[model samples]
Target chain A: MTATVPGVRRGAGPLPRALHPGAWWLWALCLAVVASRTTNPLLLACLIAVAGLVVARRRGDAPWALSFRMYLLFGAVIVVVRVLFRIVFGGGGGETVLVNLPEIPLPEAAAGIRLLGPVAAEEVLGGAYDGLRLAAMVICVGAANALANPKRLLKTLPGALHEIGTSVVVALSVAPQLVESVGRVRRARRLRGGVGRGRRAVRGILIPVLEDALSRSLALAAAMSSRGYGRTGAVAGGRRALVGTLVIGGLLGVCAGLYGLLDGSAPPALGLPLLLGGLAVAVAGLAAGGRRVRRTGYRPDRWRGAELLTVGSGLAAALVMHLATEIDPADIYPSLTPLSWPEVSALPLAAILLGLLPGYLTPPPPTSEVPA
Target chain B: MARRSVGSAALGALLALLAALLAPLSPASAAPGLARPAAGSAGFCPDASGVTVVVDFRELGGGRVVRCAHGPQADGLAALRNAGFTVAGTNRWGDAFICRINGRPGVDSEPCVDTPPSTAYWSYWHAGDGENWTYSQRGATYRTPPEGSFDGWSFSLNQEEGSAPAPGLAARRPSDGGGSDGPGGAGGDQGGAGGDSGGPGAGADPGGAAGGGSSPGGPGDAGELPPDAESDVEDEEREEEAEEEPDEEPDEDVDDDRSAEAAPLPTEDAEWSGTDEEFEEQSAARDDSGGPSAGTVATLGLLVALLGAGGLTAWRRRRAAAASTAGAGADERPADER
Candidate 1:
């Protein structure tokens, strides 16, 4: 139990305070970017492992922290669904046939489409690889959700995005809130000598939990509004219009720039120049709009060395993976047609290993007994 | 209660209908069928007994290849394979949408994970002996090429349907009198029911007609009687042509090699050997399947170790918290309770 003092370094370890929510988000999103760059299951599994390790080490004893298991289950479901789709549709034209399912002949209109036929090992593995990539992305986001406090994340948002951030934070917290409500409701039911099982038990628990959650959220909304959470100082209509135009136009430019960068065939003018220009314009607009709002922070989270190290480690992982893409694309995207085993290169593996740094380098999350 | 029973019955009927629709119409047939053992030639097929496959690597920068495929059951995809050509399809569409042939646009160029953009893709075409190329409307998996026909794959980039370049080689067989302009003469007798040979303007007609006609029979039925009969007749004619021109095979092989060496782009005479030992070696290397490599295994071990470390950290934290709670009894309740 240490006080939330600024720059209180004690010997080797930093003081046990929660890392900035923005730092956790940046780290997790960078991990997601690493996952997106490759379909190799080995690399994806490594990413999932990295995310799980970080979550286990850094997550506070919050209700939302427990939802990581649900995300893991969702990821499993995604892999299963992808494999099932491969089975239901034709499992491609790979040479290695694993199962000979009965082939269903479709009508002439559906000529190219094959219903269940022979399942190929290659096709199933390919589906699994693709599914793992998506799962890694989802789990990375989930890790961020578990490790970072949603309210704190909203607080970090710029003034221009405060109203939107408030809504988003509320939406994000709903699942954890509902979970807490359910537990409370079930505990109450147990005290009243009711069996918390079967269909009747579900109905009894569900109604009260929902009601409790709704009332709690309503109270929160009331509290937030009373405190003038989304209030903005009066500004001239023309100034508002100028800010709106700048933001919207910048956002459009960013979208165009991203499209151009991802697509090799797109014109050169729309790529890096547009992206930088759009970012500059957007930042300027946000700054101008923020000047209009009158707000003060109450012990706002500080970005210390630990936060810097955490974000830097994640960025390094992403950068290494990007460089790996240039070195050997074949290793990143293994051929599935011939059913070769997916292999990860040394460089990308080392990059993923770097993702483990934040788990050890950042101070352990403060024990929950410490009062805020 | 009565309404609920009625709804259940309706649901049951719907489920039954779906099951029936999905039920296999016949016993499982061998999917690849009985493709003849590949006897790919260095040039255009010596006779009309087989389908000749030509791959034009236009913008992808490879010389044109002509190889012959023999079999009654040879569809467009089968013909390509039977001609000793390896093809890769888009992951989304399987063998239906041809993405790469002999791995031209490699993983770095096009990953083949999805349907390639219309800007760059292998455009499918079909032609008769000494006939103009027609763009195929149907996918390769569904369309069965008739005996004596030519299956062409040209890598088209940002080209419209009409403008997409076809395989550089003239679809003429060497036995068709070595004349450059013999399509008119050959079209009269050899152009079968499927071969609607005209100029590029008339290409769409044959393709559209074949697509519509073949739908009812499907790929399986389309590969049956006509091709068998045509192959038998052509087999006899091929023997006669072989008797007449005994020394043309080696001469054509030499011609093919020379043309291949001269042209960087695909040209009429530039026919690279699809069945070359070099190509076989490359394909063999590509198809070397095995278990995970040493690096992958090491990485997996590292992942496992990380997970273990995570578990240890979590367990330690839990134990330390328990010790603290036991030591400081009613002074602090658990955070979960709050």
Candidate 2:
């Protein structure tokens, strides 16, 4: 409709030109849903790929994207180190001997060296594949974060948790403000004198920062009270109590389901039902809470063919990867020792790449320098 | 578009890097000392035909020494006193003790008896000994010196003719119990001299074909007694039973076969060499794979990550919006500020 915001381009394209930030939750929720159902490598891979593409397409240039890419790198390092440490120290009889160092415990095979010392060819390849899958997951999450703006996202929050959402939203913003305030304090100090070395910088920074933070908090509290915040003047009798109980009970049920999953002995048939029931209760609580709040005009994220493709392609790719990849991180030994290279099916990769389409179309807000 | 492509390429590179790093850490096995039996403590003593006590020496710490863990043969005279077998001779040997039952001949000197074999019994006080003892089947021998006195023991039980069931006869269903036992009575009658001569053959008879020894009864037939072929047969039967259990799958055979084919079968009592260390390796591998319950954990982890990201991203956007509209809310603050 109205392109009030700069860079808000309009087109008759199938996908929503600008996805409401709230939709990011749907993407995350979808990942969680997929994860809960299957640990099948193919499914997890497909899920990760699709989410990654969505993230890249939406907000690849955002700070989150950069950190995510780095995170992937970090994950890879961890994999290599883990494998190396294991191969050198861990035990497994192997035939192909490498070095016969006295300290290393000879035959290389007997010293717990496989493929080679601290470096089995098979284990390395498997670890790398696992690392890729992990990276894909991180990127997907990063993309979601980058693509969605905060205010719009809060709107999608279940009404039952408005206060929680608001609190969380405020707390998160505090970090950047703290960073900005530090800059201001530094500037103020620089104008007077550089605080000439030796720990004075720490004192100069801390004192002003604390004073500003406290003053701001007081001002915020006073302002909120004058505006009648949290005073909706509704009768807080039976219904309120009932709603509160439902919310707490639903939360507890969700925790119980999680505990059952952790326990592992829980029957799938029973666990799934409990989990679903808990989710249903939670959704109901949200719906009830929304009904209590003031009425507002309807606004919904536009669903288009491209957006569907974005989500579908990602989901499909993950499913396909899971099915195709025989790489069970758990069964890494057999999977690695056998050393059969899983055929990297091109079609699924292509599908996952396609899923990144939406993220490309949706750009993030321009990064701006804040005034202290 | 070029920027976007670059970004995607960067993402791919990062994934590759992560894959590389994680490769080395896939799952390290534990040290050899810790890993347990590869097929898990099975082949050690499959089933109880004759009880096999594997001391698992590591389970038993050091200090107290058992002069002879096996039976009296290895220890001889000294072992009799150590085993509390009623010392019959002067307890002279510093390392050895000779003994005989009060009414019977000492096992060290007396010949192993024939029919109605003499039973050698011994009892020791709990005064000094803890519950550590090793007793081996008589025919089994120790290649190395015994760790301590009564550290382990081995012996045999010879029965009177027609009394004990023959080898493999014990395992058969009771329905198949009726059989000829010994040739003594039959041979006596066949002499055509005394038809009433009562012998072992007269008591129980399994025709010569069924109960025949591997070779016709030779001299000292009671001495060796073929070292009990029933033990091996019993082992096979137990394996069959374990496999047939509803809970156990046939896959166990595949593993056993693989083990048999892959490595040399470790001898029963040779230096306690086996794959207990492999258990720790398997466990560690399991840990890397994120364990059996990994899928659920991964899902939950993703959910938490998403929640954090969503909340943070929203807050950032809100702060921006609030900054842009700061002056709009400034004027309304007067009524509240007062």
Candidate number with greatest DockQ: 1
Scored against the true structure, residue A190 in model 1 reaches a CA lDDT of 79
Whole-model Cα lDDT per candidate?
A: 0.64, 0.37
Give the runs in model 2 whose Cα sits over 4 Å from its true position: A1-17, A28-56, A60-67, A77-81, A84-119, A122-132, A232-238, A251-267, A270-272, A295-309, A314-334, A346-351, A360-372, B1-338
The number of the candidate with the highest lDDT is: 1
Candidate 2 per-residue C-alpha lDDT over B261-281 given as tens digits, one digit per residue, 9 for 90 to 100: 332223212223223333334
In candidate 1, which residue pairs get closer than 3 Å at backbone N, Cα or C atoms, i.e. clash? B130-B171
- What are the per-residue Cα lDDT tens digits for candidate 1 across A7-84? 224555766778999999989988887887787877887788788778877888776765676677677778768878
In terms of TM-score, how similar is model 2 to the real structure?
0.47
Model-by-model DockQ, in order: 0.19, 0.02
TM-score for chain B in model 2 = 0.19
lDDT comparing candidate 2 with the true structure: 0.37
